[model samples]
Target chain A: MSVQPQTQARTRRTWLRVFLIIPFIVLLYPPFYNSNDPTFIGMPFLYWFPLLWILLTAILTGALYFLGA
Target chain B: MFTFNPVAFTVFIIFFLIVTGMGFIAARWRRGDLDQINEWGLAGRRFGTTVTWFLLGGDLYTAYTFIAVPAAMFGLGVLNGWFAVPYTILVYPIIFILMPKFWSVCKQRGYVTAADFVKDRFGSRTLAFAIALTGIIATLPYIALQMFGIQVSLAALGIPLSVSIGGLQIELPLLIAFLILAAYTYTSGLRAPAMIAMVKDIMIFIVLIALLIVLPAKLGGFGAIFAAVAKKHAASPTTFFEFLSPKQNWAFVSLALGSALALFLYPHSLTGVLSSNSKNVVKRNTALLPIYSLMLGLLALTGYMAIAAGIKPPKSLGANYAMPLLINAQFPPWFAGFAFAAISIGALVPAAVMSIAAANLFTRNIYKEYISPNASERAESTVAKWASFVLKFGAVLFIIYIPTAQVINFQLLGGIWILQTLPAVFLGLYTNWFNRWALLIGWFVAEVLGTILFSAAGLKSVYAISIFGVSFPAMYTAFSMIILNLILAIVLTPIFNVIGLGRGRDITVATDYDAEEVLPVEAGREALG
Candidate 1:
């Protein structure tokens, strides 16, 4: 019975690691975020999206750490 | 000849002296036997998360970065400069994955330099020597650029960098500052820079905060600043870019990806990681270090602020002067002096760390391996201290005598040369199935061919390749060479193994890569010394 929970915990940890790839997928492909229509304040989507991701990435990394990833 | 500003000079000197004092006092901070190489060079691997975060930030985001990145944005535009944003953002994820494993292995087996780890893992002294030589050579031009950072700061403050003494022109202020840096590094070793980095980061944060708040309000807003950039881009469409042009997309993505891969591979960056006490410390820092990346991205926008404010630097100084000139024009003299001092101190921290890192590689891989086979820990540390001093002095002389353009050209090549080691260092972390000789040949081929490609592109780092009468869009030369390097290593590894030429031994166990920290050996030895 205990072995089943151990495997479940291990599998959950592995899935958490996959979330780390979100920033790379979103930021690395410039064509996806390279638009001007979605301007936050006055900054372009190209500029503000990457800047916003810096915070979101940090929060994600921190979450991964706290969740025992 | 130089327009002197007394208030600025005085403020700069005061901050400089404070850090100089801190440099000396840092030797006593976390008491250890300064005679041991690990103790002197890696701060006995004792730093917690906060110190490691500051040290790596100060080491990686250098003084040249402050002058050059904004200068690129102010002079050119997004594709030329702002790729650094994505580049820095991408670095943390890579670090989060790789550095904790690296830290664990190094801590378990007592590896001081990346070359030291490569030497043991591959069991080829020749391969290790190649890595050590590449690291030392690549770092020299980088150190020279740090001195260039100080020169720009002083020049901006209206302080003369050189003075005619007797018949020879001497860069007096720079020489004096370097001497102080060398003295502290020699006496305190890595501890000096580690401690000073904290102060440098705080000062830089203050400068960044002040600039972000003041510059935007004065020059309308982010919208106006970027609109001004668009207007200028329209005026000279070919020279400036408000965003990556269709043709520039490949180059932009390649540079960001390539540079993020290369940043931690540099020996100085590894030194910062190795100095931390635990794998968790290194891991936590990846989450924290993006604060500086955020600051750097905002700082890049000051280039657009320069445009909106209509601050024109002297034509001779070019766009490198744009940030300094903007600071001079907009801020009070006292604040300007404070900012220049922050930049100059910023240069000293990285310059000290790079020299120590290069020195550590020489002492561990070259001098100990070749010259003195059984040198004591005290002897190794002693040699490293002197080597760090000599390396910094040589860099100062090189910058003073060599033309700045020549130094800049070599620094451009330094990035390409250093990235070729990625196959051996980064990939070797995961698998040692690669034959050592194959890795060496791959490195050699990449170095020679990359240099040729860089030159063919007229000394530019980005190049368009034509193969079989088909042309591809320009990409970072380093990225293309690294791909070639990996292919060569992969193909030749099997051929070499088939011939029974693979004699490499792995001294490190698999568990070493995940081993949690033990109390450092130096802790017990501290009282004996």
Candidate 2:
């Protein structure tokens, strides 16, 4: 979890940063997940989709954190 | 005074006292000098992963989020309420990308405020002053709203917010609460809130978990709750939509994006970030802090739960009372008291941190930079402490004197105003290519035009503009204005350069943005001083 001090050259994994944009693209467009036809445990798609994304996005961010992007 | 439960009142008072006691004791928790601005304002930047997580969760989620998100769902349904879920989800990835660099640059320069980094990066005192002024003004109504959150909780508890003594009206209860808050904040600075944030967050989480489990069971289940929400929306098609209509789609997207972008730009959020010990701490917390967002999403559903419970808030308290009333209806008096204390204590943590953040801006960018160029570190810290007191007191008076609707309107505009700083603060992190004067011009134009647009939209944050008889769908005012702000800065930079306007010197080196800790070069500046 500690940043490496001896790594002089800055980690410019700018390509890895693209993974960060996935949640924004997925979650921002309500049209993509706005339907209620799909229900999870009685919650409609509209409701459950974003709630599920919260966990997914957290994992996405956690992955990014681990990759040191 | 509609339903005074003495048990709830006593329980609320007891928990309030516990946090107040903890607030005072926090000064010694990680003990730093009380007379240095960095030490006092940022807890000497020693917060590790877990502490920073709680501090930020408590800071960003806020009492406003606790009350208003559910309140919006209860009152206005999806567009108004559910957008917050996506907004919170989107913010962390943003923090994951942006804040580590911001923390790195600030640490390397000993920058106490974002405006401090802007001033150095752009080398424009006027631009820096613009940023400092905006941060302070934008946060003022926000702090007032935290007081409003406490007022709503007390009202729900049937406690008198004000009292008459000798024919003089006094907000005695709120005054007493704020005085206790002010005392500890003055004595302990950011440490008070950092310590208390741990308590506030745990209590909030417990309340959230209890409500999520207990309420759904009482009201059938999530299926039944959504059925109730859908039924209500069907009953009032004009007011509430169970899903985003085609036209409302862009507005929701923009609102979510705009607010997510604006959340961390607020000085208080950055105060939480800057207080952390390292970029890794900030990065780690971004991943962890979404736990609050998950809580917020469930909390927003409580508004739907209120609908399911058939709860109606009194006309005086309005929708904000829905969550508290739902609690009172479903939980016992003692639990209601604990929930109310969780909320009011929730309000106190952000209020303290925001005032400290705003005070830091004024001291570093305005007072020390302009009013007294030769201010000693002790003198600077002293000014910040007093400034924090004055700002909090001012907000208390603002809540007591002003209409809550007016405060809400200003807070809406505050969001728009703060995002205008992004060109200088957020974009300034990666590159210093933009001319200083160009960035200032961009900020000025965006702020003025944004306010005008907000007014044009009847002070709503969403507006649909028709240009040349071709109408565009409504979008978030902050989102639209930020685009304009960015375009203006980008177009003007080369123009300003070619016209022979000089750019300010950047004091930071490229590696500063990737540095793991405060650079020795910054320490050298302090030594020279």
Interface RMS deviation of candidate 1: 1.0
Mind giving the per-residue lDDT tens digits that candidate 2 earns over B303-378? 9999999998877667888898899999999999999999999999999999999999999999988999999999
Q: What is the lDDT of residue B361 in candidate 2?
A: 96
Candidate 1: tens digits of C-alpha lDDT, residues A16-54: 988888888888788888777688878888888888888
RMSD (CA, Å), each prediction? 3.2, 4.3
Per residue, candidate 1 scores C-alpha lDDT tens digits across B1-529 of: 2366899889988999999999999889788999999999999998877778889889988965788789889988888788888988888888888888888889888999999989988989999999999999889989998998898899998887789999889999889889999999998988898889999999999999999999889888888987898899999999998877788889999989998888888889999999988877777788899998898898888888898899777677788788998999899889999999989989999999999999999999999999998999999999999999899988998898887655666676788999999988888789788899999999999999999998988888899988899998899999999999999999998999899896699888898887845555434344122
Model 1 per-residue lDDT at B506 = 82
Q: For model 1, which pairs clash?
A: none
Cα-based lDDT for every prediction: 0.87, 0.89
lDDT of 1 at B226: 79
Check candidate 2 and list the clashing pairs: none
What CAPRI grade goes to candidate 2? medium
C-alpha positional error of residue B462 in candidate 2 after TM-score superposition, expressed in Å? 0.8
